[model samples]
Target chain A: MSQPAIETHDLTKRYGKARGITDINLTVNRGEIFGFIGPNGAGKSTTIRTLLGLISKTSGSATVLGYDITNERKEMLAHVGYLPSEVFYYDGMRAKDLLKYAASFYDGDFTQRIQDLAARLDLDLSKRIDDMSLGNKKKVGIIQGLLHSPDLIILDEPTSGLDPLAQRTFFDLIREENERGATVLFSSHILSEVQNICDRVAIIRDGRIIETQSIAELRRTAVKRVSVTAAGEVPLNLATLGLPAGSFAGAETEGPQTSFVFNGDCNVLLSALAARRLADVNITEPSLEEIFMHYYQDGADRGGAAHDSAAQDGAQR
Target chain B: MNVYLFEFRRQWRSFLAGTLTQAIVAAVFLGGMYPMYHDSQKDVEKVLAGFPPRFAAAFGITKDMFSFGGFFAFIYVYLAIVAAIFGALWGLKVFGREKLDRCMDFLISKPASRMGLFWQKALVVLTGIVVMNGVFLGVALWVRTSVGATSPGVGQFVLMALAVGGVQLIFAALGALIAVLAPRLHSVTGLGVGLGILGFVLSALPPMTNESNFKAISPFSYFNVSQMQTQGTYETGYLVTAGALCVVALAVACVAYVRSDVKA
Candidate 1:
C-alpha cells in the first residue's frame, strides 16, 4: 500500500510550557481534500507550521509525502505549497516579479501557469504589491501558491480577505487542482466552506484533536436535535432523564412542548423517551456548527465533559 | 541566489545614488577649503599652537594640521562617522527585512533553509558597503588630485580609506547583532543612528581620560588619523580586535535567527 500523503504520530509542540498542540495523531489520505477545522487560537496554525517545518515539533514525529518534516524539510517543501492567513510580500516588488521569484526556487518553469492563474483571478501583474488592496494581494497569493502546480496544497484561512466573487473563483481553481490529483489540506474556522469541499474533517480544540470523521458520518450518527412533548409535565431536569450530561442540552419547557439537542446514540435517546408518556417527539440531525460546539466547549461547561468524550467515540463509529 | 539578486537590485539604485552624492559633496566642500587654509597656514598654526593638547585632540586637530595630508586625515575621521551610520542602517534593513515588513511567513515558507537565507542577506549588506566605499575612494582620490594636495602617496591614501572601511564594517556587524536580538526592532534606522553616535562618543573619551584601554573598546579609536598620516599604517592590535568583534557578532546573529520563532 502507498503511504499516506500526510501523517503525524503523537506530534506535540509547546511554547515554554504554554499550550501549542498536544499528542496530535492524524492521517490525510492521498488525493483527498482534508479539512482542519477550528476557531482562532485553537492550534490550527501551530499544527500547519509544524507540518511545514517552519517551526520545530517539541516531541513525536510527522512527514509529508513520505519525507520527514525535520531532517528532510527542504525536500518535503519542494512538493508542498502553502498560503498563510495573512499574505505579505516584499513591498517594492511588482506582482509579476514576486511570482517569478517564487517560481524560481522550484524545479520547473511556471511561466504559463502564472499567466493562466493571473488572468483567471483578474490579477494585474503590473501593480506593485504595496499599492494593491487586500483582496488583490490575496489573489496574488493564490496565484503564487498554485503557479508551481505542487502535489500538496495547504491553505490556512485562505479566503479571509477575499470578496465573495473572488472566493468563488478561488474555490473553482482549488477544485481544478483537486481534479489534477493534488491533495489539499484546507483549514478554516468557518464550517460552511469545509462542508462545501472537504472529504473528511478533524475538529481541534485546546491543542488536541477531539474528533475526526467524514461529514456524512458526523451528521448521521453523532449528533441530533430532539424534541419531546410528554403527555404531562415531563422531566425538565436532564439528570432525571437517565441520559448522560452533554448527551442532551438546551432543554426548554413551553406549553405542551419540551425540546433539547441529543448528541448520542439514537437508540438510547429513543428508549429514554419511550419511558416518558409522550404526546409527540421528533428527532433530527443537527448542523455541523452544533456538532462542533459540542467539542469546543468540552470541559468548560460543568455539564458537557461527558459529551466531549462520547463525541470521540461517535467519530470512531 | 535569486533572493540575493532581487534584494541587491532593489537597493542598488537608491543606495548608490544617495551615498555617492553625499561622498562627492563632502569631498568637494572639504577639498575646496584646503587652498584657503594653506594660504594662511603659518597664522593658523600659530593660533592653534596656543590651545591645550587635549583640546586639539578632542577636535581631531593635530600639530601637522598645516599640511594637506594632515587636514585630509582630520576630515576623514568625520567621514568615518557618516559611513558608520550608513553601514548600520544598511545592515539593519537587510537583516531584519522579513520581520520589519511582516513577511516572515512568505519568505520562510519557501524552499530555502534559514541558514541559507541568513547568508544571502549578509551578502547583500556586505555588497552595499563595498559599493559605497568604492564610490567614496574615487571621490577622495579625485578631490585630492584636483585640489593639489599631492603630498600623500597612493599607498597612504588607500590605507586611510581602508581603515575607514574597517570602521564601517564593525558598525554594520553591530547593527546585525542588534536586529537579531531585539524582538520587535520597532525602528531599525533609529537604533542604528543612535548606536553610531554612541560609538563616536565612546571613541572620543580616551583623549580626556588619558587611558589607552578606552581606545581598545571603541571602533573610532581603531584607526588614528594622526598616526595614519605620519606612520602610514593602522594599529595592528586594534585591527585584530575589530576583526574578532565582527566575527563574533555575525556568528551570534546566525544562531539567534536559526532558533527564533517566526511569529506572525
Candidate 2:
C-alpha cells in the first residue's frame, strides 16, 4: 500500500511553560482534501508548522511524503507547498519576481502555471509587493505556493483576506489542483469552507485532536437545532417535554415558541413534542459552533477519548 | 544558491550607492587635507606642538606629524570609525532584516535548510563588508597616486587600509552575531552607531590609562594607527585576536541562527 501523504505520531511541542501542541496524532491519506478545523489559538497553526519543520517538535515524530519531518526536513519540504496564516515576502520584489524566486527553488518549469494563476486571480504581476493590498498579497502567496506544483498543499487560514469573488475562484482552483492528484491539508476556523470542500475533518481544541471523522460521519453526529411555535402558550420548563435527560442544550422559550438543540433519538423527541397543541416546527442541522460546543461541553466524558480508538481504526481503513 | 543570488540582486543597488558615498567622502576629505598640511608643514607642526599633551594623545598625535605616513595614519583613525559603523549596520541587516520584516516565513518554508539560509546570509554580510572596504581602499589609492600628493607610499597605505579593513571585519561579525542572538532586535542601526561611537571613545581610553589591558576589549584598538605607522605593520598579537574573534563570532552566529525557533 502507498504511504499516507502526511502522518504524525504523538507530536508535541512546548514553549517553556506554554503549550504549543500536545500529543497530536494525525493521518491524512493520499489524494484527500483533509480539513484541520479549530478556532484561533487552538494549535492548528502550531501543528502545521511542526509538520513543515518551521518549528522543531519537542517530542514524538512525523513524516510528510514518506520523509521524516525533523531529520529530512529539506527533502520533505521539496514536495510540500505551505501558505501561512500571515503572508510576508521581500518588500522590494515585484509579484512576478517573487513568484519566480519561489519557483527557482523547485526543479521544474512553472512559468505556465504562474501565468495561469496570475491571470485567473487578476493579480498585477508588475506591482511591487510593498504596494499591494492584503488581498493582492494573498493572491501572490497563493500563486507562489502552487507554482511549484507540489504534491501536498498545506493551507493555514488561506482565504482570510480574499474577497468573496476571489475566494470562489481560489476554491475552484483548489478543486482543480486536487483533481490533478495534489493532496490538500486545509486549516481554518470557518466551517462552511471546510464543509464545502473537505472529505474529512479533525476538530481540535486547546492543542488536542478532540475528534476525527469523515464529513458524513461528523454531520451525522451533529444534533439538530429544533424550533417549535406552539398554538397555545407552552410550559416554560423544557425538562417536562420528556426527551432524554441532558439531550436538550441551551434550551430557551418564548410565550408560544421554544427552541433547543436535540442530540438524542429523533423518535423520542418527536413523541415528546406530538402531544403539544398544533404548532409549527422547524428542524435543521445545528451550526458548527453549536456542535463544537457539544463536544467541548463535558471535557473527556463526551467520548473524545473513545473516538480516539475509532479514529485510529478509521485511519487504517 | 537561488536565495543567495536573489538577495545579492535585491541589495546590490543600495550597497553600491552607500559604498561609493563612503569611498568618495574618504578620498575627498582625507586627500584634501594632505596638501594643506604639506604646504604649511612648519605652521602645522608649531600649532600641533603647542596643543596640550592630553589633546595630542586623544587625537593620536606623535613626533612624526609632518611626514606623509603620520598624517595618513591620523586621517585613517577617523575614516575607520565611519567604515566600522557602516560595516556593523551591514552585518546587522544580514539576518535581522528578515526577522524585522517578518519575511522569515517565506524563507523558512522554502526547500532550503536553516543552516543553508544562515550561511547564505553570512556570505552576503561578508561580501558587503569586502565590497565596501574595496571601494574605500581603491579610492584612497587612486587619490594618492593620481594626485601625487605628499602621501605615504603604496606599501604603507596598503598596510593602513588592511588594518582598517580588519577592524571593519571584526565589527561586521559582531553585528551578525547580535542579529542571530537577538532575533527581535528593534534598532539594529542604532546599536551599530552606538557600538561604533563607544569603540572610538574606548580607543582613546587606553592612552589616558597608561596602556592598560583594557585596550584589548575594543575592535577600534585592534588596528592602532599610531602603532601601525611607527612599527610599519599591524600588531601581530592584536591582529590574531581580531581574526580569532571574527571566526568564533561568525561560527556562533551560524549555529545560533540554525537553532533559533523562527517566529512567523
Candidate 3:
C-alpha cells in the first residue's frame, strides 16, 4: 500500500492538567477525504491544530507527508494547506491582497490559480475581508487554503457559514482535490456531509476518537430499524428471537394499521415475523444521524477502548 | 525573504501612518517651543540670574537656550514622548495584531523561526522609528533656518536623532514583551502606556533629586539632550546600558512568545 499522507502516533495535547487529545492515532492515505466528526468541545480542532503545529503537543508524535510535525514544521507546513475553524483576516486587507500574501510563501503560478478558485467559489477578491459577510469570508478562506495546491488539506469546520449551494460546491472542490491525489482531513458536525463526502469517518468526543469506519461498513454494522404489525398483541419475549438486544415498544393500533417499533436487526425480526402471522411489515434504513447517535451516545461510555478497537478495525480494513 | 518582505509590505501602510503622525506631533511640539526659547534668551544675565552653578551643571541649561542646541533640548521631552508613543503603538501591533487577527498560525506555519519573527519585527520597528525621526529632524532644521536661528550641524542632529531612536527602541521592546505576555490587546496597550508614564515620571523625578543613581533605572534619564549639545556627544555608557536592556527585553519576549500557547 502507498504510504499514508498523514500519520499520528500516540499524539496527545494537554492544556495544563486537562487532556486535550489523548493517544490520538490515525492515518489518512493519499486521495482520501477523511471526516473527523465530533460535537462541540470534542478536541477536533485541537487535534487539527496539533497536526499543523499551531499548538504544541504535550506528548507523542505526528508527521505530514513523512515530515515530523515538530522538527520539520516548516517543511511539513509547506505541503499542507490548512483552514482554521474560526476564520479571521487582517482588518485592512482586501481578499485579493490576503491571497497574494499567502501565495508569497510558495513558489507557483498562484495568481491564476487563486483567481480560478475565487471564480469557482463565488468570492469577490476586491472586497475588504473585514467588510465581507461571514460566508464570503469563509469562501475566501477556502480559496486561500486550496490555492497553493498542497498535498495535504486540513479543513476545520469548512462548511460552517456556507449556504447549501456553496457547501455543495466546496464538496465538489474537495473531491477534485482528492482526485488530484491530495489527502484531506476535515472536521465537521454535520453528519450528512460526512456520510456523503467522507470515505472514512472518525467520531471524536471529549478529546478522543470513539470510532473510525467506512460509510458502507458503518451502515451494515449499525443497528437496524424494524417495524412489524401483528393481528394480536405485540410479543413480549422478543429479545430471545436472535435479534440484537434492544427495547421492543408495545404495538400501536391505528384504524386499520398495527405497528410495533423494535430497535434491532430487521432481518432476524423479519424471519420471526415470517414464521408468525403478520398483517404488515416494513424495514427502513436508519438515517446517518440515528447511526451516529447510536455510536456517540453509547460510545461515550466506552471511551479510549472503543476508539482503539475501531482504529484497529479500520487499519485492518 | 519573501515572507519577511510580505509582512513588511502588508504592515507598511499602518507603520507609515503611525510614523507620520508621530513626526507631525513632534514638529508641532518643537514649533511651540520657539516662543519659550525666545523668551528665555531675551537677556542672558536675566535668564541665568537666579540659577545656581550647580543647577546649571546638572540640568545643562545655560544662557544658550536661544541657540538651536538649547531649542533642541527644550523640544527633546516632547519628541521623546512622541517617540515613545510611536514605539508603543508599533510594538502593540507587531506581535499583538497577529494574535488578534488569528494570523499567527499562518505566520508561524511558514518556514520562519520564532527568533526570525522577533528580529524581523524589531527591524521593522527600528526602520519606522528612523523614518519618523528623520522627518522630525528635517522639520526642526527647516523651522530653525526659517526663524533665522543658527541650526546645529547635520552630524550633531543625526546623533541626537539616533539617541532618540535608541530610547524609542527600549520602549518598543518593552511594549513587544508586554504584548507577548498579556493575553489581550487592552492589557498590552495598558501596560505599554503605563510603563511610558512610569518612565517619564522616574526620569523627571531623578532631576529633582540630588542623586544620579536613582535616574539610572529609567531609560529616559540616559537621554540628556542638553549635555549632548554641550559635550557634542552622548554618554556612551548610558547608551550601551539602554541598548543592552532592549536586547535582553527582546530576547525574553521571543522566548516567551515561542513557548506560550497561541490563543487562536
Q: Fnat of each prediction?
A: 0.68, 0.72, 0.60
The residue-level lDDT of candidate 1 at B142 comes to: 82
Assess each prediction's global lDDT (C-alpha) against the native.
0.81, 0.81, 0.74
- Quote the TM-score that chain A achieves in each candidate: 0.89, 0.89, 0.85
How is the predicted docking of candidate 1 categorized under the CAPRI scheme? medium
TM-score of chain A, predicted model 1, versus the true chain A, to 2 decimals: 0.89
Residue range A160-259, candidate 2, lDDT tens digits: 8999999999999999999999999999988889988999988887787877888877767737888888786763357777777667776678777787
Q: Where's the lowest-lDDT run of ten residues in candidate 2 chain A?
A: A308-317
lDDT of 3 by residue, A87-129 (tens): 8887789999988888877777699999899989888899999
How high is each candidate's TM-score? 0.92, 0.91, 0.85
Please, what are the lDDT tens digits per residue for candidate 1 over residues A66-148? 98998888888888999998899986889999999899888888999999999999999999999999999998999888888
Q: Compose the digit string of candidate 3's lDDT tens values, residues B1-264.
A: 665575567668866776686667656655665656575665655767778765653444556666766766755655676677668767877767687676776676655566667777777777777777777667767776666665566677667656667778888888888778877665555565677677666666555666788768978768767777778877888878888988888889989887777666
Pairs clashing in candidate 2?
Answer: none
Each prediction's number of clashing residue pairs: 0, 0, 0
lDDT of 2 by residue, B41-118 (tens): 888889988988877877777677656677767766677787778778778877687877788878888898888988
Residue A280 error, candidate 1, Å: 4.1
Q: What TM-score would you report for chain A in candidate 2?
A: 0.89
Candidate number of the best DockQ: 1
